[model samples]
Target chain A: MSFDITAVVNIMGLAAVAVFAISGALDAARQKMDILGFMLIGTATGIGGGTLRDVLLGNVPVFWIREPVWILICLVASAVTYFIAPKLASRSRTLIWMDAVGLALFAVVGTEIALEFGTSSLIAICMGVMTATFGGIARDVLCGSNLTLMNEELYITTALAGSVVYLLLNSFNLPNSYDLIGGFLVAFILRALAIQFHLKLPNPHRKD
Target chain B: MSFDITAVVNIMGLAAVAVFAISGALDAARQKMDILGFMLIGTATGIGGGTLRDVLLGNVPVFWIREPVWILICLVASAVTYFIAPKLASRSRTLIWMDAVGLALFAVVGTEIALEFGTSSLIAICMGVMTATFGGIARDVLCGSNLTLMNEELYITTALAGSVVYLLLNSFNLPNSYDLIGGFLVAFILRALAIQFHLKLPNPHRKD
Candidate 1:
């Protein structure tokens, strides 16, 4: 049976935007930001990474400006998150899972886009990781929180691994569907494990 | 005598990039980051604002990617600043002035580019301010410093005023050179006065 891989990527991309928006709203709630701040930060988190990737790759008008459906997803997701965040007993847990899914989807989609743009594998891999992580970094920065990059957690490493996996699978001429799913699963499982086991990289500054 | 307005804008833009790179290197020094960190942050600060503006306006390949000279300027300025920062007795003073010059220049140049792109006046003005201010904001975020946006300072206000000035001059059919210079003077002088007088906008959170 033939399947449209592009269709699946687009759908998953929207899901990624929604989850990122929810994560951003949760961050805004942590900061006790106003409604306007919530919307702005949430939208930024949803679109920031993809926008940066498209721009660097010279894709004009950026993704949100072209389709705008991406922006609508961000707004709706953020507003819903704002209302439900207070009622959730385990907000942090929800945030972690949401972020992991977003990271995995964005990493694979971004790498695919860069490859389609005819960029080198190295650049494509880097763009994938950037697309996965930069949105959260922008959210933390706007919230004036400590940078997630400065943390010793295996956060960026997971994205990097996923991008590499996707590139490897593509090189092996695997079905595009399998490559996408394999990349996403590797990233999500790795990140979930990191969160579950509190896995961290070695910090030179930390005395053992 | 007919003057090439584009040439002048291009040259001054380089100057602006140089000053911004210096400021970023100084910030890296304050954080005691490694040499690689110095170069990375310096390049980001030097080109960050313009890159965002170009991407948003759909000016593909970005200014630096098309003309690698911009990146070269950033590297040289950053390395020079990294070396001289230790000997300066009042590094903060140098930083402030360098930042002011860069802001003024970037604001006018950015506004001109947006207008050339046929954007609405309001959008052009916003892009101008974004081009002037986003680099410093990114620098502060990367350094994990208290966001300058959180301060009640007139920093963003000055860039706004400069953008407005450029737009007003263009509307009045002034010479292109005069419009650029007029905007720069207004922004720089206003910022200088604010610095000298400790002028600040009223804070809503502050009790008299």
Candidate 2:
């Protein structure tokens, strides 16, 4: 609603950038891309969501363009991950957990931004989901991973739920911290459960 | 510099959308993508550049959002291509020529937009290149094509040259028509030459 909440979102956003950057860097390494590829994919994944959200919300110059610290962070995080991927290869689960946290945070952040821009709840929720998931989607597209692999994933739904929960709590005029933390917990727990149980949306159209 | 020029660019831009949409649809067909894929890729290709330009220039809601006729055109063009690609499989070169025209027009249009936004000539030139090439890049990324393969192509350079030529002519305060037509010709001729002679940027990293 104000500068205080925006500041909170900015602080939490850094963790999202780090995990997303790492994920992008690892994908580049698997494809035998050079440093250029590492940086390109990493930056794209880290900022792609927010960029899309900002553009749709009519926010010019975008957040990263305005401050540039986010860009620097993505570049550094991705570069560092490129060097550490082999060592962290066996610890991939740690990366996954971090990714979940990023996803949860992005959902709330994106929705908050859209609402601040005076958009309707529906559009705000869409932005939230896009903000949370577009990074991974772009990463997959760039890496040429199995494109349909996400068709049955609950990832996008989790983001939507997270955003909805945040808005719901905020509508009750709850403290910003309560809404933020509750939304984060809602998203994180749901995603963790999905990951733990290997939960998937059913697809009758699937040949298998 | 004025409404007259903007009108001409808008007219030419439709052609760009059609060709770009067809290209996207063809790629989707090759990938065995569904109708949704065809539409998604087609729209992305048709409007991707202008949307990027608008976002950067603080032009909110974008041209398409302002007048969705362009979106309809892209969708219709893509659908038509989906139905006709099999019949036109051997005559794809016609499609290539149309693509060149679109590329040329996009370069000038993008440059014009940047200049209108009060950007420096250098930035305007970059926008031109982005407008001309980003659609195809998005298509390629979606299709999982080899991204670096374009590095050895003259595509982006052609866009850059075309844009610079437009800005140079505009600086002289030439008749707007002259600059627009000249820029289009410059881009089209260069691209046509490249395509005809199988010209490519030298790959210093090439093994062969």
**Cα-lDDT of candidate 1:** 0.81
lDDT of each residue in A1-208, candidate 2, tens digit only = 3558657667778978978888888887777665545666887799889988887676876776555677778878887776677776677999889888999999998888899999899998899999998887878887788643375347887898899999999899987777887888899999899889988788788766
Give the per-residue lDDT of model 2 (tens digit) for B111-157: 98888877777667757877887788788887878663254236766
User: What's the DockQ for every one of the candidates?
Assistant: 0.19, 0.18
Off by over 4 Å in 1: A34-36, A89-91, A206-208, B1-43, B46-50, B56-58, B63-137, B146-208
**Model 1, DockQ value?**
0.19
Residue pairs in clash, model 2: none
lDDT of 1 by residue, A13-103 (tens): 8888988888888889888887777888999999989988887879867889999999999999888887787875276677668778888
Show model 2 residue runs off by greater than 4 Å.
A1-8, A147-153, A201-208, B1-51, B60-133, B141-144, B148-208
Cα error, residue B98 of model 1, in Å, equals 14
Chain B TM-score in each of the candidates:
0.91, 0.92
Residue A32, candidate 1: C-alpha displacement in angstroms:
2.8
**After TM-score superposition, what is the CA distance of residue B143 in candidate 2 from its true location, in Å?**
5.9
